[model samples]
Target: MLVLLPPSETKHPGGDRDPLDLAALTAPELTGVRTELVETLVKLAGDVPASRAALGVSEKQDDEIARNAALWTASTLPAIERYTGVLYDALDVRSLTRARRARADARLAVGSALFGLVAATDRIPAYRLSAGSALPGLPTLRAVWRPALSPVLAALPGLVVDLRSGSYAALAPVPGAVTVQVLSERPDGTRAVVSHFNKAHKGRLARLLATTTAEPDDVVGLRRLLRRAGLHVEHDGDTALTLVVPAV
Candidate 1:
């Protein structure tokens, strides 16, 4: 099964690897849209003020514009390695065993605003782009992405566990894919969707699934695998799982 994750907004600044190359990314079918976005960002980076405005950055965060300017020339790192946040910190790919790391590389994919979807080991550089960013002359990112992105995701073999959040998931719809939602149980026996800690929980779930040996092809089998990993899971529908956590 393939597990789809959301990309983090924060990233490491530099890397030792080579520069960006669209043709070499995992989903070649997205190269067209990727190239368009890359060029748009690079050009927008020419004017620092324009870049800052376009990316929703303030004066202090202008360095992000410089990063965009160097998109093609900046050193690269694996997509998983480049991202840094609560989610990535929880996933913690750095500490995994070699075999489990390899398994993660094979099973994980990140839903990207810039790259559309990239595999775990896909090399990428530091850049700033979010699902909500409206680039000059471009329509909503979801509008530009959906048509090209959906077909590629649909064509992937085997079951898919979609873990992408809001706008990232809006970029492409993964029909029939099993989705997992994290819910918090309150003292009054009430349950509500998790918020702040949600990403961390999803990250943990992704890490657990990535390192596991079991391959689940359906929602029931997926729940079985998650249960085997010690998660407290409950079914939501024919295609959804709700993992319960005590309220914080």
Candidate 2:
């Protein structure tokens, strides 16, 4: 099974290796669009004000723009190591054994506005861009991504568990891909969709999915796997799973 994850806004800075090489990333079909976005971002970085406006960043976050400016020449890190936030912190990839890490590299992929989709081991630079950001001379990200990305995702082998947030998922629709929803259950038995701790739960779920030895080719097997792992999983539909947690 393939586990699709969302890219985090917060990332670890700097790396010890060579710069990004789009040709080396998975899904070579996305290269054309990836090159276009990388070039656009590098050019936009030259204009600080425009870059800030386009990227939705404030003056205090000028360092983020600087990162974008260095996109071509900056050092790179594995896609999984680069993204850091509540979700990634919960993933705790560094704690995994080398064997498990290899499994993660094989099963995990991240949804990116800049690159479309990158494998966990793909080397990428620190750059600031969001799915909602509209570049000065380009069409909407959805318009630019859907036509190319959806087909690639739809043709992937086996089951697909998509854990991307709304905006990223909007970039490309994966037909027949299973989606996860996080909800909080209160003492009175009422439940509400989780907001603050959503990513943390999904992070744990992704970690479990990445490391498990069992291959779940359908939603039933997927639910069974999650349940055996102690998650409160419920079938919302043939292609949707709900994870219930104690209300905060």
Query: Candidate 1: lDDT of 157?
Result: 85
- Name the TM-score of candidate 2: 0.98
Model 1: how far is 44 from its true place, Å?
0.3
Cα lDDT, all candidates? 0.92, 0.94
> For model 1, how does the per-residue alpha-carbon lDDT over 1-248 read when each residue is reduced to its tens digit?
99999998899888975999999999798999999999999999998888777788889988888888899899999998889999889999999999999999899999999999999899999999999998999999999999999999888888899999988999999989999899999999899999999999998998998899998889999998888778889988889899999999
- Compose the digit string of candidate 2's lDDT tens values, residues 56-156: 99999999999988998999999999999999998889999999998988999999999999999999999999999999999999999999999998888
Worst lDDT run of 10 residues, candidate 2, spans 11-20
List the lowest-lDDT window of 10 residues for candidate 1.
47-56
Segments of candidate 2 deviating more than 4 angstroms: none
